[model samples]
Target chain A: GQQVMQIPQYQHVQEGEDFTTYCNSSTTLSNIQWYKQRPGGHPVFLIQLVKSGEVKKQKRLTFQFGEAKKNSSLHITATQTTDVGTYFCAGPVGAGSYQLTFGKGTKLSVIP
Target chain B: SAVISQKPSRDICQRGTSLTIQCQVDSQVTMMFWYRQQPGQSLTLIATANQGSEATYESGFVIDKFPISRPNLTFSTLTVSNMSPEDSSIYLCSVELAGRYEQYFGPGTRLTVT
Candidate 1:
């Protein structure tokens, strides 16, 4: 079984401030994915990191995959009110399972 | 990402009752999954809703308690049998689209068992 844990369970920051959440896994992963769940909404796919030490970006958000495939990270720059939500990182295990292990999440609240 | 819709967005059921949540996808998919999230908690895997076959349950979930039906590629249903207070949570259904390698989730059914 694989497990993912995210740091800063809860965080409050002023608008325009930067934030970072770290995810560590209990077992090696073949690929990792990130999701965002808005208040009272279902989870939405954000990005997927498959290679070792991979990095990708979408506007203000930056994602990094660890070389060891045991960890990942999400960083937001100049956060806006729209960025307030829970971010979950999921790791897909080996072949055939297609099961994803998700982190508890990092809850971010942007204070204007 | 595929579009997904879930039925009975929210409900309040008495103890010992049951709820059946339905999920419909706009496009045909290969993999459909079910998950549960308690109040302010992370998502937990329930089972992988297999089309034309019985679902595969997780460590804590079982078929008798949480029976799932996936008759086709784009439709599925999860029935929470003999509900209890502890069963109150948000149940979600997701689909992993073919060739995309991305999973999209349904809005989810919020169940409250009293």
Candidate 2:
């Protein structure tokens, strides 16, 4: 069995402040994916990191994968109210497996 | 990207009742998964519903309680049998398109058992 752990179960920040969530896995992953779930909406795919030590950015948000592919991080610069949601990091249950093992997720609240 | 639709967006059921949630994808897909998310909790993989064969359930989840049927490649149903208060949660279905690793989740069925 595989497990994914995320840090900072809940976080509150000023509108202009920054936020970061860390994710670690009990086993190495072939690829890691990030998802965002709003207050009442379903989980939406945000990004996916495949290469080790890869860094991808989407506007104010940045995603990085560890060199060992066992950990990852998501950083949001100058967070806004719309950035309030739960961010989950997931990885395949096993190599070549489509089933994903999701981390507990980090719930971010950006105060206006 | 696939367009996914789920039936009965939200429902309130009594104890010992069963609710069947339907998941339909616009296009044919090979992999479909059911997940349960409690209030302020993470998504838990319930089972993988692949067309043609029996579903593979995760640990602590049994078929008798959460039976699934993948009658076709684009449609599936999950029945929550003899549910109780603890079964109150949001049930979501996700599909993995061919050659795409990312999964697209449905709006989810919010269930509340009293």
Point out where model 1 deviates above 4 Å.
Answer: none
TM-score, per-candidate, Cα-based: 0.97, 0.98
Q: How well is candidate 1 docked (DockQ)?
A: 0.85
Clash list (residue pairs), candidate 2: none
What TM-score does model 2 achieve against the real structure? Answer: 0.98
Q: What's the lDDT for all of these models?
A: 0.90, 0.96
Every candidate's chain B TM-score: 0.96, 0.98
lDDT of 2 by residue, A1-112 (tens): 8999999899999999999999999999999999999999999999999999999999999999999999999999999999999999999999988999999999999889
lDDT of 2: 0.96
- Give, for candidate 1 chain B, the lowest lDDT window spanning 10 residues: B95-104
Cα lDDT tens digits, model 1, B1-114, are 788999989999999988899999998887899999997889998999878778889899989999999999999999999999999999999998775556899999999999
> On residues A9-33, what C-alpha lDDT tens digit does candidate 1 reach at each position?
9989999999999999988777889
Candidate 2: which stretches are off by over 4 Å?
none
Best by TM-score: 2
